[model samples]
Target: MASQAPSRVGKTLIALIKIGLYLFVLALVALVVAVSVAVSQLPSYQELVRRDDLGQMIRVRAADGSVIHSMGPSFGEWLSHDEIPAIMRDAMIAVEDRRFHYHPGVDPIGIARGIWVGWTRDDRVRGVSTIAQQLARNIFLTNDRSMGRKIREGILALALERRFSKEQVLELYLNRVYFGGGAYGIDAASRRFFGHSATELNAGQAAIIAGLVKAPSNYSPTADAEAARARANIVLQLMVREGAISEAQARAANPQQVEFVRTAERHNSARYFTDWVLPQLETLIDETVQPIDVWTTLDVGLQRAADEALNANAPSAQAQGALVSLDRDGAVRALVGGRDYVDSIYNRATQATRQPGSAFKLFVYLAALETGYTPTSTVVDEPVTINGWSPRNDNGRYQGPVSLRAALALSINTVAVRIAQDVGTRTVADMAQRFGITTRVDTNPSMALGTSEVRLIDLTRAYASVAQRGVAVVPYGIRRVTTADGTLLYQHRSDESRVLVAPWVAAQMTDLLQAAVMTGTGRAAQLGRPTAGKTGTTSSNKDGWFVGFSSGLTTGVWYGRDDNRALPGLAGGRAPARAFHQYMARAVANRPVENFEIEVALPDWQVEPDAESWYGAPDDYQLVDPDGNPIQPVEDGPPPPPQPREPGSATTEELNQEWLDHAIGRNRAPQAVPQERRGPPPDRGPPPRRQQQEVMPPLPGQRQSAPPVVRPTETPPPTIRPRAPGTAE
Candidate 1:
């Protein structure tokens, strides 16, 4: 019996020893598991998503930490962790993974569940990616939906978990996700749909965002509104099944009238300004350089106003035009570069160098004012010829003894010619250049009548001088540039110069221009605010121009056909000034009303043309100084009138030869001369313009008869589609 007891004790001891060995092995395995979990939660993997320019975009708002616009180097924005809503967090996690909080960034149970569902449907496991895994796929892995790639994504996701915490992973995921409709993440997505930021979103909004994660392209808010709603319903259903939402609450959160804005669509908001600003980039940046953003001083409301007015008032002639607005400091506040960008990138405001016609008279008048001429200076208005060139008033009728102010206010051409004579034509040209006229100038005396070419942008900035106290300032578009990481790149600075005119001169000029709006051609541009402006009409009714300014804004408007065809005989007050006024009304609506300071020394001058009595004409009336000194008329004199050849006193060719010799100097001639010189001496070539410009006619003072000849090719390309019978001339 003692031998049996000893055997039992030995057996019991052996059993206890086996259990102790098993427990020791299990304890070792648990320690390895815990250490692996801890190792997988580092934050160093953030380097994968880093950008070099991130510093430039980090402008901590002086007012708050909130960033204004995309102040960083990256094209899109990154949302901060604190800024995200709790509901958003829950929705994403619930939709992507229910075990997200429990798992170490990878859920084996969810994977098993997905594999089972996919196997039942098709021999495939669609997904069961945890939120961390989804983020890893989006940020670090290619989005190829395949098993091999999925395995790689899983590996990378586990690696990501090992390098970053769950919270950090979630934040990165939110910032890097693509939410469709040109929106990259929740921030842009919120703005696109709700017209606000992500912070302002409610549950419905948050749910819509979560639903879009599966198929952002198909269910984007802007692409298919109804489809997006259907997608939201699916998300709501899922939430209810998961107890994240109640049935009643889901029913109440109907997405039925919810507007889905596709922020990706190119909204041609400031089309005219967009058109006008293209070529100006030549001075701002090189085309081969990096893609830089241009932050123009565009006033959204004013731009809308201009678009509305243009659409409401545009002529039926293919519907095209532009409006430009500048601030008191010469910053282009708003610009409608054209009616549409897709139609033609021709950027009429900066590229179309068309004739200003009577609008050209504004510069002529301004130059006169700057050079010993005043608003009251007397200028003769009549049909007169220098050499053989004669200029008539717009109506072919003259108003005698008109004051300089009245002559300019009414845009009388003959008086403007006389004023140009008083100030040298070259002087006028130089002054126009200083005012920002970059287009080709004809150097002809008719340049005073704006027969020379001019673009809308330079023309607008030239007129901006009057409102800016005679200081010629280059227009500034971008305020500054920043790096991708909120670091400083560059700030734009303007190179301002004082154009030839004095402040007081511009002040008085502004007064005259204001009077034009009050009672003359620019009456249409009259706003309730204190304002000043000028109206321009080109020859044959080819173009219309209105340039104006208030204390806060300066704007210019131009209307014409790209083919140079004439539209209706609507004067500057018709559409151009109306557009300027409309844009300015909105541009200055919220700004304080103030007056331009009259600070230049006033120079006294005498009365001018009322509309009659042509003065400073080639062979007509003379320009007398204040003390009755005869002043020589300066002009690009016209050619000699055609002489009736003695059956052939000279062939039309010889006639043009003689005319060209005297009209232009022997060194220069019109391109039109070659065809006429080849044809017979005909009566058809001399239009009213040619008639008024009778200077240096081949054989003037002799009237003779001849057969009429027409050259179809030489006929000016139907520049003016004149509607008004009398005005067509």
Candidate 2:
């Protein structure tokens, strides 16, 4: 019986051996088929290396030539084996594949260890990909985890090893692997994260980059810096254990010292600006261009300021604010489209159009000045029905028979409507268009009160024209576009600006606007400099605006709810003006103080009956002397003798008459009149006794002085007038 049992056992063992052998052969056949198919479909090594299918990469740079954003795969200069730092290579090899130098394309030891650990731990299998295998998968295959994909990856890795040396394989792997933040290759990753070249990377920086190969987004420093640093520490430990780096060296490599080129917050803040400029690239460059660099007019510092101010000063949690800043030449310096770009990408500054309210009064008053109405011209602020629609003052009270300067300073809706009725709303619309308001303007009388919807960018550009002294302004962002190889594709050219408004008319409008900021609703926008701007508030407080210029920078701010719901008490003088002040305070901190060119003299009439002048008491106003100092008070005594008037010198009344005659097409030829006539009369002497007595009053301890003399050659600085009590918009 024992002999029979032995024989049966031997037979069962042979049968088991035969079944095992057959299964092994069947698996071998399947692997062969998969490898053969993968080989047949594999691209040539040259094709994989060329990477011709990569998407067009766009790098947007600020005016200061710093990279602000990148779209699509970002690749840096191709680095050779010797060009790559030894620390980077060692870190990569130690963490990615310890036996990379001694193993074939497939690492049996790594695979076996990974399988045993995964089985014993009851977890998902750990990655056992060698550098060559990773390179093959990245360049030529998908990241599928099926057995078929594994066989193909192995075959492709073996083929790559056969075609290239170990050094070449490592170089290709390091140069072609993906890092986070749209970056590919070690060079791009280094420059993107460290703002430098790959050759300058230290051990910690190298380790940080090396750890990204397993999962790019999961360990991105910009996204989750703590996790990234932790992964980097693991890489350093691996390098130390691999004998590639000493323990002390690993300890010396601090991941905290690695500073990113840009903070995550700054990057997100600039995204709005970049997104606005990106779509313009297709029109600026040829469609066939593969990769290009766009140089924009964005000032990073000003952009930061704008973002901070808008976010910090937004009136309400539900409201959104937009800011647009431009240089005198109309180059966009800073733009913030919305409160938070991530929550919503709707760019309120450039895309959203809202009612400008009284801010639209600029066009109405500018049209009036062009038609010969001086700042001191009388305009009655009375209740009047126009087509059954009555436009009342914002404060529900009107100053009867107010001067144009006072009317605008107080933002009186009735006076603006009266002036618009006389000047014609079509003329007002045309004047606005001529000054760079691209939006459609209504011809209705309510347009005088800014009922017409307009974009913040267009409104801001119009103000820039005034700042530029009547020169047309075309707001532009892209300064230049170039190919990756530095071939110029597009360069912005400053075309000869056509005069839209007469320089003298612009100066007069500026004078009125300066008064508005000094003693009116815009008093909150004071910058301790010669600033001129206007305040606007739509009905029900749905929209608020402050648009002004100082130090050659023109900025506009808009605040409102995106849903167009009314904010109970919001006004342009409150949130929007404060934001404008905050941003311009930082933007023009280093700029030299510049005075507005006031060619025409302010009227002798009191701008506001009860309000004091910016400098002092209403009757104590004095002009700056030839040396730019305020005229000092003299002891009570006889006034100085009046100086003789110069030849061709005319009184304020004569200049107004001439302007009216020119507007009405009188016999005098328009071109025959000199442009100098539009300015103050040739710095003539003081006015006559009657005019002096009416315009100037004696100080408490001194006698009366001559009326303020404005030299035609010297531009006068704007005054920071006090806000009148009981005045609100």
What CA RMSD would candidate 2 show?
15.1
Residues 97-210, candidate 2, lDDT per residue (tens digit)? 989999878898988998988988986567788898998888877888888877778887876776678998998888888898888889989988898999999999999999
The model with the greatest lDDT is: 2
The Cα error of candidate 2 at residue 581, in Å, is 3.2
Q: Model 2, which residues run further than 4 Å from truth?
A: 1-54, 102-129, 145-159, 190-208, 222-262, 266-268, 287-291, 311-318, 342-344, 600-729
The lDDT of model 2 is 0.78
Number of backbone clashes in candidate 2: 0
State the TM-score for model 2.
0.69
lDDT, each prediction? 0.63, 0.78
